[model samples]
Target: METVDVIVIGAGVSGLAAARLIARGGRRVVVIEARDRVGGRVHTDRSGGHITDRGASWIHGIHESPVAAAARAFGMPMVEFTVGGYQPDSRPLTYFDARGRRLEADAVRQYAADIRTLNAALAKIIAGAGAEATYGDAVERALAEQDWDAERKERVREYNDRRAQEQYGVGMGELGAHGLDDDTVNGDEVVFPRGYDELATNLAAGLDVRLEHLASQVDRSSEGVTVVTDRGVFRARQVVITVPVGVLQAGDLLIEPPLPETHRRALGLLRMNAFEKVVLRFAERFWDAGVYGIRQLGDEGEWWHSWYDLGRLHDEPALLTFAAGPAAVATRTWADEDIVASTMAQLRRLYGDTVPDPTSAIVTRWQDDPFSRGSYAFMLPGSVGADHDDLAEPVDGVLHLAGEATWGDDPATVPGALLSGHRAAQNVLGIDIPVSELWA
Candidate 1:
């Protein structure tokens, strides 16, 4: 059996980050990944001269994001989009209703006000009724208190639902009322015109990474830890399990003697959400090229609610549709032909009847993937602040866990995963590294 100072599971950003830091500290490390390639959920696929990100795409905080720093270090070109901006030539986001009517200034203002009212009501509910309240319940209470008519109420509700789905990857009912209030690194978001997976590729450089090695079990002892994989077994003094929350929840990798009660409970308190993307390549640019994204309230729930103009990023006549929460789950049951047809119908509703069929299309089914059962993690309604900390705690100083799920403030982001890995490395090395330096 091969042995090392540390054995890292999953070669995603988190595992790669941990291995890199530990190896830089003069400790031998090896990363075992189930996938044939690196970058678990940061896959970038190219087909017919078009590049599409099947997994994670954006650097949510370019200035402070470790992924962005890695991209810069790797010399990857990035493009920035002004979110929610409405300049005539540089419009980033445009909202439309079921009839394809663009949301005017007055309606947009009303929606913002309604959202503010809803958030304030939710905060009050959390303060009075505690953290057990669901975001859906809070929104309902707030909407009930408003004196709007049925049409306005329905419109606001739909907008709220879309926002919640996009942010949480689940409906408001399943999301905690206080979940959206968590702090995260703040900066302008950017995208890699080439691919986001380049960041992971650069991070994994010079590291001992074993692909197609699926970890089946982890046996921990007072002295060290043993990791059993489909290929073989490896032992190490320390193990960093950086798999996604969905993989852990699915019990894909068994832990000998099981995890501690608190850890198990904490895992249960966190929920992995479903989010998927579908990319379509058309013969010509049928949609407006100036806009970065199009948000539509569709009558049929089959098509995606948001469409990203890939042309703006790479000058390709492609559009990527994003579906989250229930819509994403529902898409899992659709066949490619059916999904393509439905998407075309939805596009026709927005771009008129002359819309052309896509020459090529690609769909991402993260929910159905065995390695990643869902997109990412979110807190349940009853979860406390310490839940993520408890999840991150090392077991016997031999078994350490790190991933986006273990990151409390910025869960479900690439930078969050990287930060969690750095924190895990710090725990194993017994060293102090500034939080900012991890990204730098």
Candidate 2:
């Protein structure tokens, strides 16, 4: 049996980050990954001349993001992610009715304003009602207000419903009750110039990562922890689990002596959010003028929220599309051909005859992948307080859990994931290392 000072499971960004930190401490560490490649959701496909990220395309924030800090340290460039305004040819769009006719822009803007007001009002109600009332309940009550008109009010209700559905995989009723409406993600996000996966690869570079080794069970009852894989068994003083929240909820990975009920309950309460990316390589750039961003059809349940050009990316001129919220459900379950077909159909609707079939397309099914069941973790309704606390705590001083999902308070970004790894390493090593020192 191969033995090490520390064993990190799931060689995603978080796992790799933890392994790097622990190994740098002069502790013998081994990272076991289920997938053939490293970087879980931070996958970069270089099959063609251009490089595209199939998983995480954005760095989110440059100043605060630890992943961004690491990238800059490695001499990688960071680019500002802008959708429109620079390109005169670029036309921003508003959601249209079921008919082909575009909805009134003024009405749409007013509708959005109304929704923000309603969310504020609803927030007050939720605060007073404690955690009992669901976000849907608040929304419903807010819609009944006397300030808005009946027709416009109806539109507002429909818009809110669709937005809620589009934002969360579950319905509006699930929001605040069983889902996350209170969960706030900052709108200002950044992207990596090279690729997000480069950060992961750079972090894992020089570290010992055992690829294609999936940990089936973890036994931490003895003095050391035993990680069981199909190929062999490895022992270590401590184990760090950085798999997705969905994988933990699947209850497939066995833990001997079993985790405490608190941690188990946290796994149930905290859920993984579906955020997928589709990379397309076209023969020619139809929207060739500027940083073109195209919003896919079925914006109601759209899998493709928006696509942008790779001009800032000097390597390849491809389009990277992101799918999140309710739109991600179909994409999560979509087959290879189905994904391409649906995307092409969406492109046809948007660009008419201009959009051509992609020369090659790469679809990443993180949800379906056994190693990582979903993109990343998000707290559901009723998941705050102790649930989030338990999710981050180490078990028996032997088995430790850390990942994007376990990052409480901090936004679930790549930087947070990397920080979570460093935190987990500190827990295993029985040291309280500051975040700044870890990076330094």
Candidate 3:
């Protein structure tokens, strides 16, 4: 068995960041990945002269995200898109209230403000000292405190539940009230230039990465942790595990002497949400060359959050359709034919007979992949931000955890994964590198 200062498991964004930082410290590092490719979930498929992102594509915000800095450092162009560009449907921009009524401009503005204020107040309550709250509780409190007519209250509750579900995939019963702040905590969303996979590949460049290596078990009984991979056994003074939260919950990997009670409990408390996208390509721009659409289907919220033009690319007929919450979960069991047919039907309703049939359609099912059981992780209401600290803590001087799941403020964002990886490496080595210096 070979030994190194640290053995980072998984070559995802977080693992790559950890390996780079640790290796920069003059420590021997080995990055073992399960897939043949370097990037874990961040994969781009290039076929027929078209590039389709199979995994993460958005930085969410360039000004505040580390992904933007990484892109700048590599001279990659970061593209910006308007939030309104992502509408629920493609045509007939009709605003529908929770009561299934078409909300006028004034009503829409009022509802939007109500949402903003409620979210802000909830965030403030969590930022201060209090028991960890879930999104359900926070919204409930907001409703109780505010004096509104029954119709308005019903509208607000329905709207909040639908959007929150679409955002995280887990409905109110399963989602954390406290987790609502994860999206806007830092205030920005940016997409990578070229593709996010490019950033991952660039980061993994020149690093010693062992691909097609699946970690089956981790032995931590010894003075150091021993990782058992399908290819070989690697012993390291410290091992940074950056696998997805869903993978950990699946118990696919064996742990010697078992993980501590605390770690196991923390893993149990964490839940994975499903967020999937389907990209349809046509020969010509069908749904109004550059227009975005939002369609509300039956007050349950959007079956697809919205559609956007692949404005970054030229001569491309592509519309990226996103599904979150129940719709996403339901699609897990759906056949490809059914998903495409249903989505196309929705497009017809929005585009009013103008939507063209897609020549090629691609749908990503991350939930089925053992390596990445789901897209990303989100906290429940009671899991306070401090729980993130507990999750990120290095254990027994041997095992360390890092990933987007452990990122507190920036969870579900690329920058958060990078920061988590850097922090995990620093924790193992007892070093403190400010966030500013990491980007520097």
Give the top-scoring candidate (TM-score).
Answer: 1
All candidates in order of TM-score, best leading: 1, 3, 2
The most accurate candidate by lDDT is: 1
Error of 3 at 154 (Å): 4.1
| lDDT by residue (tens digit), candidate 1, 1-440 | 99999999999988988888888888999999999999998899977677888888877657656677767767899888644111121344676766788878676666667666665666676655456887777677778887888777776677666666777688878887766655332566677889888878888889999999999999988999999998999999999999987888889999986889989999988888887777888889887657787777545533466777887678668888766788778777989877778778878888899998899999788888999888888778887656887888989989999988888867778877888999998998999766444434
In the range 267-335, model 2's lDDT, one tens digit per residue, is 777666665666777777775355345432233324544566766566455776655556567566667
Q: Each model's number of backbone clashes?
A: 0, 3, 25
Using all chains and alpha carbons, the TM-scores for the candidates as numbered come to 0.93, 0.84, 0.88
Scored against the true structure, residue 212 in model 2 reaches a CA lDDT of: 91
Q: Which stretches of candidate 3 lie over 4 Å from their true place?
A: 82-107, 120-133, 144-151, 185-188, 288-293, 297-302, 312-315, 434-440
Go through the candidates in order and give each one's C-alpha lDDT: 0.79, 0.68, 0.73
| Cα lDDT, model 1, residue 6 | 96
lDDT value, residue 257 of candidate 3: 70
Residue 264, candidate 3: C-alpha displacement in angstroms: 2.1
TM-score of 2: 0.84
Candidate 3 lDDT over 386-430, as tens digits, reads: 566577777787888889888877777677788898898788768
